[model samples]
Structure formats: C-alpha cells, structure tokens
Target: MEKKRTISVSVVNEHGVLSRISGLFAGRGYNIESLTVAPIPESDLSRVTIVTDGDAKVFEQIIKQLHKLIPVLNVVENDDFLEKEMALVKIPIEEDIASIEVLCRAYNGNVANANEKYIIVTVTDKPYRISSFLKAIKKFNPKEMIRSGTVALERY
Candidate 1:
C-alpha cells in the first residue's frame, strides 16, 4: 500500500540542481504532489520540501537516488517536523465582512486587504486546514485564490 510522505532535502545553491532533482522523479515515473524550494537564509544552500505518495520500496529508491546527487547535502523524511502552507483568497467586498472575518478567524486567516470591490485574505495553516477553509468560505464566492506548497522543518 502506498502512503503519503513529506521529504525535506538540503542542497548546495547552484544552477541546474533543481532540474536534476526534479528530473529524478520524472524519469522514474513518480509524481510529486507538491514541491517547494527556497534558499536557507545566510547560507549557500537551499531547502526543498516535496510531498509525495509511494510504497516503502519506492520511497527507498527515491532516497537512494537523492543521496547520489552531486549537490544534495542531506535528505530527511517527515517523521517529526513542523509544516505549514499559505493561501491567499480574494472575495467580492460586497459580501458581508462580519461573516467573512468570522470564517477567517476560525481558520487562522486574516483579512489582508480590502478595496472597494474585493477583499484579499491570507491564511496559513496545515494543508488539510487550508482545504477545509477554502470549502467553508465558498459561500462568500471568492474571486481568486492561490495556495503555496507545503514547507517544513525537522523537529529539533
């Protein structure tokens, strides 16, 4: 049986590294559900968070391939980690602001901006919570929304 897994990879900040890493999964007929990459502050390295689903054997192969990459410094699975995703949604300002604010508060979201016609809200939470919040706010008829891929750090 396949199981969902989150992998955190550290790599030397250099050209073509991301392509090479992504290629590894594509070449193997594997799917990356979500991928987020950003530089580690004050360091010449980048952190990549990948969410995927696979069986034990497949995950083993994935880890082995990552280990062989020239610029890959380390690979860690999310046995214990802190993870969060962010989403921005724009809804028509004509909607009831009180209800919208209540819904936002329920999901750790805030009204980030409000104009004459649209209200932009920001929500940061776990992936499932983000999805739930979107569904709950559908009554407001959101005009646009975008969500960030998951980002994580191993527990100390």
Candidate 2:
C-alpha cells in the first residue's frame, strides 16, 4: 500500500548535491511531498529530509538509487528516526489573544510576537501536531502562515 515515508540522507557539502538527489526522484517519476536540507553543525556535511509516498517496492528502489549517488553518505527511514516541523502562524490580533495563547501552549508553542494588526504564534512539534494546531486555530483566520518541511535525526 502507498503511504507516507520519511527519509533522511547525509551527504557531502557540495554544490549540485541537492539537484542531483532530487533529480533522481524526478527522473524516476516519484513525487516528493516535503523536503528539508541544511548544513550539519560543525561538519562538512548536510542533511536532507524527504517525505514521499510509495509502496514497499518503490521505497526500496528509492533507497537503492540514493545509495548509488556519489555524495550521499547515509540514508535513514522514518522508523529509525525522530522528526519535527515548525510553523509560524500570524493570526488577527483582534481575535482573542488569551485563548490563542492557551492553544499554542498545548502544542508547545507561544506567541512569538504581537503587534497592532496580528499575533505571530510559533509551534514546533511532530508534523501531525502542527497540522492539528493550525486546523484548531483557523477560526482566527490566519493572515499569514509558513511551515517548514520535515527535519529529522536518527533515533540513536
């Protein structure tokens, strides 16, 4: 059955690495649902987190192809990792700030900023929790919102 699969790849910090990796998936007709890439702290490496949908066979093929890439160092699947995503939501300040704060608190978030026009609330958590928090706060009508793609690390 097709389902969401999260993969984290460690690769050398080199130009065009992302393009080559992404191109592999594109060339194979796979669609990436979410992708996050950032330099590794104090190291000459980067981490790429990709969320995609496929069955067992297709997912295995992706991992095999990923291993063939010269720059890739390691590949990890979701079950062996911890993941999180962040979202910043700007809601109308005219709406109840107190209630909003409470909701944010429940989701490990807080009012990052408050101005005359809007309140910027930030939440960092599992992707599903972030999605739920956003849905619950829609009554305030988010004026602006941004969500980061999945970032992950090995469970060890």
Candidate 3:
C-alpha cells in the first residue's frame, strides 16, 4: 500500500548536495511531494525534509540508499515528527477584513499584509489544519495562494 512519508536527512552543507539527493529520488522514479532544506544552525550540516507518497518497501530502499550517500550524515524516518506547513492567501480588499482576520486567528494565522487592492493572510499549522484553513478561506475568494510545504522536526 502507498502511504505518505517524511524523511529528514542531515547532510553536509555543500554545493550540489541538494541536487544529488533529489537525483537519487528521480533515478528511482519516486516523486517528492514536498521538500524543505535549511542549514542547521552553527554547523556544517543542513537538514533536508522530504515528503513523498509511495510503497513502503520501495520507500525503505530509498532510505537505505540515503544512508549510503557519502555526504549524508543521518537519516530520520517520520516517526514522532512534528510537521507544520505555512500557507499564504491573497484575498481581494473588498472582502470583509475583520471576518478574514477572525477566521485566520482561529487557524493560528493572522493578516500578514494589506494594501489598497488585497490582503495577504498567513497561517502556520499542522498540514491537515492548513488544508482546513485553505478550504475554509475559499469562501473569501482568494486571488492567489502559496504553501510552504511540510517542515518537520523529530519529537522525543
């Protein structure tokens, strides 16, 4: 069966590291659903968080291959990971601003920017909650929407 998975890889912070890691997935014909990469503070390592949906057996092989990569320092499977996603939606200024702010607050979000033409609302929450927020905000008729896909950290 196919299941969504998140893998966090601690890798050497070097040029082309991202491409090599991504190439590993492409070479295997696996698709990455979302990917986030950032340097680990005060270190020569970066954390790459990848979200993919695929067969368990094939996913395991990918993890094994990740472990074998020379620049890979560590591989963390999705177990006990706290995942969050951020979504930004632009709504027409004609919409009720107060109502939009109230709705955003309910989803742990707030009005991030506003101008003569539109309001940009930002939300950060669990992926599922972000999805709910997007669905709920549809009534406001968003002009543009973009999501910063899943960023995860392991929880002890």
Candidate 4:
C-alpha cells in the first residue's frame, strides 16, 4: 500500500548533496511532497527531512539509493514518529478578522497579528491538519501563504 512517509537523512555538509538527494527521488519517479534541510548545530553535518509517498518496497529502494550516495551518512524512515508542518498565511483585511481568528483557533492555530491592510495567521500541526486549515481559510481570500517543510522526530 502506498502511503506517506517521512525520511530523515544525515549527510556531510557540502554543496551538491541536496541536488544528489533530490535527484535520486526524481530519477525514481517519486514525488517529494516536502523537503527541509538544515545544518546540524555545531557539527559538520546536515539533516534533511523528506516527505514522500510509496509502498514498503519502493521506500526500501529509495533508502538503498540514498545510502549509496557518498555524502549520505544515515537514512531513517520516521514511521513511528511525530511529524509537524507549519504555515503562515497573510490575508487582506476584507474578511472579518474576528471570524478568521475563530477559524484558526478551531484548528489549534492562531492569528498572530492584525494590521490595517492584512492579518497574519500562523498554524503548526500535522500535515493533514495544516492542509485542512489552509483549505478552510481560503474562503477569506489569502494574500500570501508560506509553508514550512515537514519536521519530524521519532517517538520513544
């Protein structure tokens, strides 16, 4: 069964590593829904979070390909884990700000600020929750939207 999976990779901090990793997915005809990369604090390594959809066989193949890359240090599929995504939306002040606030609150989100021309709403939640929130908020006519790629950690 094809399903969403989050893969966490540790790699040497060097140029082209991101392209190599992304190229592997592209070559395999797998779509990356979200990708986040950041250097590990005080280390010469980087962590990459990739969200993809595939069955077990395809996922294993993907991992094998990643491991073959010279810069890749480790690859872990965060199946038993907690994952979250964040989004910030700026909407024109045409809609009722109070109504938007209430909608955000319903999704465990918040309207961070309101100004004369626009309002900024922030949401941090599971991927689906964030999607739903965005869909719901669309009725207000968003002026801009920014989504952070997935970030995940294994559950103990």
Candidate 5:
C-alpha cells in the first residue's frame, strides 16, 4: 500500500550530490513530495530529508539503490524523526495587524516584517500545524504565502 514516508540521508558534502540523489528517484518514476538538504554543522556530511508517498515495496527498492550511491553515508527511514516546516505569508497592511500577529503567535510565529504595503508573518511548526495555520490565515485574505520543505532529524 502507498503511504507517506520520510527518509533522511547523510551524504558527503560535494557537488552534484543533490542532483544524483534526486535523479535516482526521478529515474524510478517516484514522486518526491518535498525535499530539504543542508550541510551538517562542523562536519563533512550533509543531511537530505525526502518526503514521498509510494508503495512500500518500491520505496524499499529506492532505499536499496540509495545505499549503493558512493556519497551516501546513512539512510534512515523515519522511525523516530522530528520534523518541522516554516511558512511566511504576506498580508495586506489594511488588515488587522494585531489580529494577524495573534494568529501568528498561535502557530509559533510572529510578524517577521512590515511596511506601509504588507506585513510578512512567519511560522515554524510541524508540517500539519503549518497547513492548519495556512488554512486559518485564509480568513485574513493573505496576499502571498510560501512554505518550506520539511526538515527532519531522527531522535535518539
């Protein structure tokens, strides 16, 4: 059966590693829902967090293929992963700024910036909470919104 899955991979920091890893999925006809990659702090490795929904069997095959990649150091299927996402919404200045700030605070966010034209509010929370924040903020009629890909780290 198909289900949402998050896989965290540690790889040597180098050029074209992202392309190669992503290409592996594309070559297999797998659809990646979200991907976030960044170099590990004070280390020669990087973390690549991928979110996808697909058949378990196919997913395993992809995992196996990932292991064969030369740069890949670790491949962890999220068993105890903590995930978070961030979002920013631009709302018209005419809207109630206080109310918007209140809403943002509810989602672990705050007014990131503001001017005479628009107010940008940012929130970082679990993915589902980010979705809920987006939905709830719709009542304010935000002018623009952008969400970041999921960043995950495995728990001890």
Candidate 6:
C-alpha cells in the first residue's frame, strides 16, 4: 500500500546540491509532493525535508538512492515521528472577512498578518490538515498561498 512519508536529509551546502538531490527523484520517475531546504543555523550544512508517497519497498529504494548522493550527510525517514507543516495563505479582503476568520479558527489556524487588501492566515498542522485548510479556503479565492515543507522530529 502506498503511504505518505516525510524524509529529513542533512547535506553539505553547495551549489547544485539541491538540484542534484531533486533530480535523483525526478530521474527515477518519483514525484516529490513537497520539498523544503534551508541551512542549519550557524552551520555550513543544509536540511532538506521531502514528502513523497510510495509503498514500503519503494520507499526503501528511495532512501537507499538518496544516501548514494555525494553531498548527503544523513537521511532519516520520519514515519514514527512528530511532523508539522506551516502555510501562509493570503485571502482577499472582502465583506466576508469575519467569515474567513471563522474558517481559519476552525482549522486550528489564525490570521497572523493582515493588510488592507489581503489577510495572511497561518496554520501549523499535519500535512493533511494543511491540505484540508487550503481546500476549505478556496471558496474565498485566495490571492496567494505558500506552504512550508514538512519539518519533523522523531518521538522517543
């Protein structure tokens, strides 16, 4: 059975490393649902969070392939972990501002930043929850939406 998985990879911060890593997935005909890469604070390394779907055997292949990359330092599959994704959605300012606010609250989200024309609602939750929030907000006709890649930590 295909299942969702989040993988955290630590890699050397170098040019083309991101592309090379992503290419590995693309070249192998695997789809990356979400990808987020950022440098570790005060370090010359980067952390990449990738979300993909595949069966257990396929997932193992993906991990083994990732490890073969030159820049990869470590890789961890976050199946047994605590994971969260953050998203900021910009909804147009209309007469339904109050209604939109209500929807946000219902999804464990909040209007973090607001402007005259658009309000930025933020949500931090599981990956599927984020998707649900986005789908629910579609009726509002969002001006822009941005989602962070999954960031996860293993549970003890």
C-alpha TM-scores of all predictions: 0.97, 0.96, 0.96, 0.91, 0.96, 0.87
Q: Which residues of candidate 2, in runs, are more than 4 Å off?
A: none
The residue-by-residue lDDT of candidate 2 on 46-105, one tens digit each, is: 999999999999999999999999999999885876889999999998898999999999
Candidate 2 TM-score, C-alpha based: 0.96
TM-score of 6: 0.87
Please give the distance, in angstroms, between residue 38's alpha carbon in candidate 1 and its true position after superposition. 0.7
Q: What is the lDDT of residue 97 in candidate 2?
A: 91
Is 4 or 5 the stronger prediction by TM-score? 5
Pairs with steric clashes in candidate 3: none
Each prediction's Cα lDDT score? 0.93, 0.93, 0.94, 0.90, 0.94, 0.88
TM-score winner between candidates 1 and 4: 1
Model 1: CA > 4 A from native: none
Where does model 3 exceed 4 Å of error? none
Candidate 5 residue-wise lDDT, 1-156, digit = tens: 898899999999999999999999999999999999999999999999999988889889989999999999999995588999999999999998899999999999999998999999999999999999999999998999999999998888
Question: Model 6 clash pairs?
Answer: none
**Residues 39-94, model 1: lDDT tens digits:** 99999999999999999999999999999999999999857878889989999989
lDDT of 2 at 50: 98
Residue pairs in collision within model 5: none
Residue pairs whose backbone atoms clash in candidate 1:
none
Q: Lowest-scoring 10 consecutive residues by lDDT in candidate 1?
A: 77-86
In Å, residue 54's CA in model 2 sits off its true spot by 0.4
